[model samples]
Target: MILRQFLHREPVAASYLFGCGGNASAAVVDPVGDIAPYMEAARATGMRILYVIDTHIHADHISAGRALAEASGADYVLFEDAEADFPFRRVKDGEVLELGNVTATVIHTPGHTPEHLSLLVTDHTRSTEPWFVLTGHTLMVGDLGRTELASSAEDGARALFASAQRLKQLPDHIEVLPGAYSGSVCGRSLSGKPTSTIGFERRFNKAFRIEDEEQFVA
Candidate 1:
């Protein structure tokens, strides 16, 4: 399996490309506003771009999902609960998107936004261990997404707590690839690195350290 992460130097946002093999099928997660790099990469690898998805309607940058989908004849997808007028497929919780041999399972995690969703990628060819999780704004490296962007602090905090709780139930060995890194304002605090493991973050992340909902909200 191949997973490529594209980092935006100015904003420190991460875009992702995941696939199985060269000249195979691929999917893009949280594509930036520019569509050239994604197209080029897919072309060079001789892969077909089947899906272009966003975790949410980004408040920080304009998304290139529509453009990429149009250019590649791929389906543009977003969380089903999203409040957008854009033409795209609505991905529901537990929904699985297949890209040749790779499968990405959607996990509805609303907190950063009412429609926020994360992906659990699995390469059917490999063992059952999840390849990685594509976390848009729900979970970050060292901290969690802020609670005041899409809703009031209290409301967002409550939702975030539940969402985080759901994620905490997962096996600690899973890999997590968050969207924003250092420069983005989405999360309270984040690592500069693009990738992290659930076990490592659970041990080091401040959000994960909070056991009680009241303490977590505080």
Candidate 2:
């Protein structure tokens, strides 16, 4: 399996490109800016870009997901519940996209947005167990994504807490790759670090410690 993370500075966004090297097929997640970088990454690995996805409707920067898919002739994917004006491949909760030795399983995690999703990735050859999670604004390095963009902050916070519970069910070793880190308005108190492990966040992240639903909302 081949995996690469593209980190940005201006918007504090992150994107990913991963797939099975043996299969020469790859996928991109939460793409920002132009599609050239993604194209170059896939070309470098001699892989075809098969899928391009967004975790949710971004409230900050403009997304290049659809454009990238179009350029690469790849399938554009989104959660089934997402409301979009354009055509896309809608993946339901628990839907798995198999890419040879690697697989991405969609986990609907609504909070920042009603149709938000997080991907649980697994490398089948090494272990059927999940390898990492592409959290996309649902869970950041140090804090959780703000819910007030699309809905009331209270309602969004409540949904976020519920979403956190779902993430908590994963193994502690799973790596967390979030969309926005520090320097972004999406999350308050976000760490400048590029990534985190579920165990670390669960142990130290203030938001994850709040288990009470009402308190979490507040």
Candidate 3:
């Protein structure tokens, strides 16, 4: 499996390009403006862009999803429960998308939005075990996403807590690749550093440390 991250410095959003190079197939996640970088990466790697997904409908910056999909002839994917106006391949909870030696399992970990999904990715060539998670806005380095973007703060927080539990169930060694970092409005205390692991966040994240639902909600 091969993966590359495109970190946007302006708004602190990070997009990903990943898949099995041997299969000549790849996927893009949480893309931002100027898709040239993604196209260039695909060309350089000799991989076809097969999937384009967003963790949720973004509010901070314009998304380049549809444009990239149209240009590449790839499937634009979203959660089955998302309320959207355009057409997309709706993915269900626990659905696994296989591309050669890489497998991406979609986990519907809603919190930042009602339809948010985090990807549990495994590079089969390395190990059958999951190696990392692309946690869109659900879990970050120093914090989790703000819970009031698409629903009431109370309701969103409640949902977020429940969703975070699912991620914690994964092995502690899985690295976390978040969608946004510091300077973005999506999360209050996001880290400037781009990535982290599950074990680190589970032990230190304020939201993750709070076991009580009421405390999490408040």
Candidate 4:
């Protein structure tokens, strides 16, 4: 698999481009700002952008996902229930997007927003097991995303707790690639580091380690 992370300092958000290099197929996630970089990356890597996905509607910064998708003739993707003005390909929970030898399985993880989702990626060439997860603001390095972004704090917290539990079921070795880092307002105690693993976060991340729903909400 070929993966590239685009870290935006102005918005303090992270976007991704990844797929099967051998097949020359790729996907972009949570893109922000200029779309030129994404297009250039795909060109340089000899990959065609098949899908452009936005994990959730962003309240922090304007997204370039649609623009990029249109530019590349790729499908613009979002959760089935996401509220958006433009047309997009709605994906359901557990839906798998194939990129030749690489696959991205969708997982509903609403917390920061009602339509929030994460991508569990696997490379068939490497192993059948998942390699990493693109956790868009739901789970971060040192903190969980703030609960009140799209709904009541109590309601969001309850939903987030359930989402966390679902994520906990994944293998411990899978990597965690979050949307934002320390400077973003989405999480309170986020780490500067943009990536982590399930096992490490389960053991050390304060918010992620909380097993009790009440304790986590509080």
Candidate 5:
């Protein structure tokens, strides 16, 4: 399988593309407003764009998911709980998406929003452990994504607490590839590095240091 990451320099955002060998098929996660780069990447790899998935309805920047789907004949997907004015398929929790030899498992990890979801990708031909988790706004490198993007800050904060705890409980070996980076307002804090291991964050991240459920959630 092949993995590619795109960093939007202006917004300091990150988008990921993952697919199988020969680049005959691919999937895009959290694409930016400009669909050109995504198209170009798929073209270069000789892959047909299979799915254009969004974690949530972004408040930071307009989503080009719908546009890209229309242009490439790919499936446009979002959380089943999120309501949108556009035409797209609702991806439910536990739903598995197939892209050639690659597979992405949908995880309903809400808190940043009521409908937020993360992708757990595994390349069956490569390994059993997840290739990497595409954490939209749920988990970041240093700090977790802010909970107040869509609802009340206090409520968002409460949900965030629970969400972070869930993430902390995952196996230490899982690799994380989060959405936004240092410059984005979507998260409270982000690491200088774009990606990190779950073990590294579990040990060094401030949010992961809490031991008690109440304290951790608080």
Candidate 6:
């Protein structure tokens, strides 16, 4: 499997393009401005973009996901419950998208938003164990996403607590590739570093370490 991360300085967001290099199939996630970069990446890598996914609808910058999908003739993907008028390839929790030897499994983690999702990726060539997670706005380097973006803060917090618990079940060594870092408004106390391992966050991230739902919600 091959992976590329696109970090946008202006918007303070991160996007990813990754897939099986041998099969030349790829997927892009949480793309921001300029579809050209994604197109160029696929061309340079000799990979066909099969899926363009947005972990959830964005309230920040306008998304380039649909535009990229159209430009590349790839399927635009979202969670099955995403509240969007446009058509997309709806993915459900536990559904797997295959990219030859690389596979991305959907995990519903709705807290930052009602339809938020994360991708647990594995390369069969390496092992069945997951390698990393593309955790949209749900989990980040030093903090979890802020609640109340799309719902009441209390309600969102409750949901986020549950989502955090689910994520904690993953192996500690799995890497975390979050959508945004320190400067983004979605998370407070975020690390400038864009990536971290689950174990690192579990130990160092204050909000993520809270085990009690009531304490977490508070």
Residues 161-208, model 5: lDDT tens digits:
776777766788888998888888876668778899788988887775
Q: Against the unseen true structure, what C-alpha lDDT does each candidate score?
A: 0.86, 0.92, 0.92, 0.96, 0.82, 0.95
- The lDDT, on a scale of 0 to 1, for candidate 5 is 0.82
- Stretches of candidate 6 off by over 4 Å are none
lDDT for model 4: 0.96
Give one digit per residue, the lDDT tens place, for model 6 in 1-218.
98999999878999999999999999999999999999999999989999999999998889999999999999999999999999999999999999999999999999999999999999999999999999999999999998898999999999999999999999999999999998999999999899999999999999999999988998
Give per-residue lDDT, candidate 2, residue 160. Answer: 88
In the predicted model 5, the residue pairs found to clash are: none
Alpha-carbon runs more than 4 Å astray in model 4: none
Supply the global lDDT for candidate 6. 0.95
Candidate 4 C-alpha lDDT tens digits along 1-218: 99999999999999999999899999999999999999999999999999999999999999999999999999999999999887999999999999999999999999899999999999999999999999999999999999898999989999999999999999899999999999999999999999999999999999899999999988
Model 3 residue runs over 4 Å out of place are none
Per-residue lDDT tens digits for candidate 1, residues 1-218, read 88888999655689998887743899999998679999989887778899999998898888888999999999999998888876789989999998767889999998898899999998878876677788888888998898787899888888988988888877888999998888788876888887888888889998966889998887
- Measured against the true structure, the TM-scores of the candidates, in listed sequence, are 0.96, 0.98, 0.98, 0.99, 0.93, 0.99
- Per-residue alpha-carbon lDDT of candidate 2 for residues 1-218, written as tens digits (9 for 90 to 100): 89989998766699999999999889999999978999999999989999999999898888899999999999999999888999999999999998889999999999999899999999999998999999999999999999988888888888889999999998899999999888988888999897999999999999986788988887
Of candidates 6 and 2, the better by TM-score: 6
Query: lDDT of candidate 1?
Result: 0.86
**2 versus 6: better lDDT goes to:** 6
For model 6, the run of ten residues with the poorest summed lDDT: 55-64
Tell me the spans in candidate 1 whose CA falls farther than 4 Å from its real position: none
